[model samples]
Target: MIIRLNDMVFYGYHGVNDEERKLGQRFIVNLEMQTHPETDSVIKRLEDTVDYTKVYAEIREIMESRQFLLLENCANIVADKLLTDFPLIWKLKLCIQKPSVPIQGILKSVEVEVQRTRE
Candidate 1:
């Protein structure tokens, strides 16, 4: 089974610049998760599948927990936490977007993506 969560926005203090860490900025996260449920029968109960609510809460907690210098670090933490917390989730793709990047050129956003699977 697959579960997807898209456009999860959060304001966080993450960047290399001091101003960015102090001011913070909006980050959009997209997640795609693949899970394996016991048996191929119809999944009738919440226990049979991964609870996305818990996943969201866990992600929010991680995002808001502290400041990081790179989005890659944040992505790694999210992937690690989710995979560790939920045993059913076998793989995941995570994308994090920094909408307001303090750079020289005008661009839509800067993004970092990572994929992880259970070992």
Candidate 2:
């Protein structure tokens, strides 16, 4: 089954510039994962599925815990953590968006996406 979490926002200190790291900014996270349950039948228990509340908490913790120099690193970190935390997940796709990036031109946001699979 596929589970998706979209537009989870958090304030984080992540950037290449010193000012950006110090001032921090808003970030948006989107996650999609494919999990295999032990049984193909309908999920009757929480243990039969990935608990997304735990997933959100873990993502939030990762975002708030440290400073990343790039969104690519941030996305990768999240993907790695999720894969480790939930072994049932066979594949994951994640995106991190920075809405208040420092740029001379007007733009909506800057985003980075990473996809991973368990081997």
Candidate 3:
């Protein structure tokens, strides 16, 4: 089965630049997770699957409650936490978007994608 959590937004300071870190910015995250179902469940249910709400809450807590030096580290932490907490999930693809980025040229948001798999 496949589960998705899309466009969850957060306001936090996560960037390489000092200004970007001090000023803070808006970030958007999209997470897609793949899992295997149980063989003998009487009824299929979301509760038995990965909970997107819990994932979102975790991400929000991580982003808002702490300071990170880089988006890469933040993404890694999120992926690791999700994989560790959700045993049913086999694979996860996480995308983090930094909108209103601190750049010189006319461009859109910059994003980072990370894929993690559990044994």
Predictions in order: lDDT? 0.90, 0.90, 0.84
Candidates' TM-scores? 0.94, 0.93, 0.89
Between the candidate structures 2 and 3, which one is better when assessed by lDDT? 2
Global CA lDDT of candidate 2, please? Answer: 0.90
> Order the candidates by lDDT, highest first — what do you get?
2, 1, 3
For model 3, the local distance difference test gives: 0.84
Candidate with best TM-score: 1
- Cα error, residue 1 of model 3, in Å, equals 1.1
What's the CA error at residue 52 for candidate 1, in Å?
0.5
lDDT of 3 by residue, 23-106 (tens): 888899999998865532432677677777788899899888777878889999999998888887788999999888777998
Error of 2 at 18 (Å): 0.9
Off by over 4 Å in 1: 37-42
Ten-residue region with minimum lDDT total, candidate 1: 35-44
- Candidate 1 lDDT, 40-92, residue by residue in tens: 26667988778999999998888877899999999999999999999888889
